[model samples]
Target: MAMRVLETITNMTQLCQKIVHINIRWSVLNKVPFFRQSFRFLWDRILMCSVGKSIQYRRLHRCASSPSPAAIECKFASGDPTTTCTDYDKDSDLVALKISLLGDCQIGKTSFVIKYVGDEQEHRCLQTTGLNLMDKTLFIKGARIAFSIWDVGGDHRSLDHVPVACKDAEAILFMFDLTSRCTLNSIIGWHRQARKWNQMAIPIIIGTKFDDFVQLPLDMQWTIVSQARMYTKAMKATLFFSSATHNINVNKIFKFITAKLFNLPWTVERNLTIGEPIIDY
Candidate 1:
């Protein structure tokens, strides 16, 4: 906070100096004594106006009750379940990131969230009529990263919950059942609905039940993979073949999200093999 204030002050000071220098140069070039005399009065008013507006803007952001944006990021290592995901609900400094899960019913949308948030936190989930909300707080480095995950029911009634679930979300996960092609097709609709509420949230296409998906014939797997890749391309999203049951690519997905959000180095390589759990960006 101190550093930010100092930096803001230094930047405003330099900017004021530049503006004053430019105006003084203009007055001197024109060789007008009256303009020179007026420049001092104008300069005084300009500096006062600039400082007043800058202070006003800073005051607006200085609300003590509002949650601050996440600045301290901990190294989120992929494929390691122990890196984070603790129950840090009381931490006032915890930077909360909202994530919405959209998919068809029985397509493992809730299961996918449970897999990432863990079974212990499953009891903490707040389930209402159409929406399922769960929270997972991660202790990273010295800061807390909380994920407020909203899973909307796949039924038609859940459409009402989409707007609330997606509004101000940091990322939205579009899930599908790998064994069901119709479920995969519905993801585009879900994506459209989510975008209506938030166009800036990171879009991710997740194929659930990958374990069962691999049990199908090799040709079917190839077809499903190709279709998934095509949809991923169309949506301009990152695709991950996941299984809540087997826990494949479950933790890794959130790690990828955390790393991306904080601009951390992502060490996971892309995999396009049909039989393997694919991770494509």
Candidate 2:
């Protein structure tokens, strides 16, 4: 019985690899009929297999509505696994996604991620010379989903990591310090660099340190937000103002991504009030 189970598992692995190969060759093949049948077969087999770990969702709300993304340009799967996640995710059948965070130095990229993944997981994050990698898993309808986040340091020396970080990423977040216009201005260059590797990754503009931003004069806030909105329109990306300290818009950002990807209904209103954090599409 043990040998039989091993053979079945091995066959399942090979089938999954073939399906992934088809996805990689999608544009070149353009064989809709073949892919349709292939995926149908794959799904039937997957549904019958009852293996993989169960992870609890991290404050993820039950989504009832269909997903509505701001734009649909390109898509890519996760790159080669860079680091092993905590044991919590091993052997799990969760849909793993790659997310990239790019910005100038000390723009709160690490803090933003730490808040979402939690402090314990933060300690397990791999801190290399120029990159940081963290993983988080969420449970949805008994199925598990994982996000392997790549944070490229915002200095010139760390620029080499951009291509690796962006490659195969499903989403790329271009972050900036809300109090510094210069950091915000750096978004154009960062966007250009990232687009070189993956053009289809969902783009998101995030302004960090909202707690400090609100203390500025209302006129200054208006000017900054106006510029941010312009940038968002230019990139055709979603815009969000967040504070890791206060946990403002931090969770909502990931929730938005999940909803958009899964076609789940999301009810988020645009907030343009000067004193409040902004969420504009």
Candidate 3:
């Protein structure tokens, strides 16, 4: 009976050793690229299954108690966020400005705002129902500028609210989709309304979806550019071609506008191709 017990113990020890060997092999396999990718795919699937979509949108507001400009960060909340005191320094003589974005429906206004504010892009595009407001504070040439950006919906029903939003705006960004010629043409009416509301506001003409626009035939590309230049000249507005998705000229647009508005000396270097304008493509 003692001999039988000893044999049983030896078999159990061998089984335990085999189990440890299998675990070590698995650990090594996880480090391999192919096995790692396969594991990641499975893990993502498991996570998706476990956490079904229950996504919620929260508004971000800045806290007033934050004393320093660098320390001010957005605070998440359930309702429409209000402006915070950190947006200005009373002692520094900060300037508060309102900027309005005007454009037709589905013309990438919201996408531009999201990209500017460092937010993730939404996979599906949705129309803005009424108005969406975002605030950003910028330090330019020893002066603090607080901007209250208002994005008004472009539907016909939302047109009534445009005058109110544009009433005291310091600057206006008029956007149009490059893929749609109708949207480009509609800018005239939008510009007219903006001028009627705030004649002093600096106007900027932005051509959105520039990535898709460049894929068109060369002649068509030049035609749109010519039209943009004509309208810009007539309206005395700065012209910019931008693609929020590709991050093309997105930051430059705002920087140029701020510099122009503040009368700050700004210079941009570009390689000229003989016939092309020196603007950043």
* TM-score, per-candidate, Cα-based: 0.70, 0.71, 0.61
Candidate ordering by lDDT (highest first)? 2, 1, 3
Candidate 2: RMSD over Cα atoms? Answer: 16.7
- Model 1: colliding residue pairs: none
How does each model score on lDDT? Answer: 0.80, 0.81, 0.67
Off by over 4 Å in 1: 1-92
Q: lDDT, candidate 1, residue 45?
A: 68
Cα RMSDs, all models = 15.8, 16.7, 20.5
- Per-residue lDDT of candidate 2, residues 1-281 (tens digit): 99999999999999999999988888657777788999998875675454321112221234222324332111111111322234553543446778999999989999999988878788888999889999886644444567899999999999999999999888999999999999999999999999999998899999999999999999999999999999999999999999999988887788778667665655467998889999999
lDDT, candidate 1, 1-281, per-residue tens: 99999999999999999999999999778888777889987986687566643332233234322222232223433324654566565654456778989999999988888877777778978999989999876655445677899999999999999999999788899999999999999998999999998998889999999989999999999988999999999999999999988888887788777666655445457999888999887
Q: What is the lDDT of candidate 1?
A: 0.80
Clashing pairs in model 2, backbone N/Cα/C closer than 3 A: 65-264, 65-265, 67-263, 67-264, 74-200, 94-144
lDDT of 2 at 199: 99
Global Cα lDDT for candidate 2: 0.81
Q: Write the per-residue lDDT of candidate 3 for residues 1-281, one digit (tens) a residue.
A: 99999999999999999999999999787779887798998986686556522110000112112223222222211111342234444623356667899999999998887776545223322335677777665543234556677888888888887898799787899899987888889899999988888998888888898888878887777777778778887888877778889877666666655555544345344422322332532
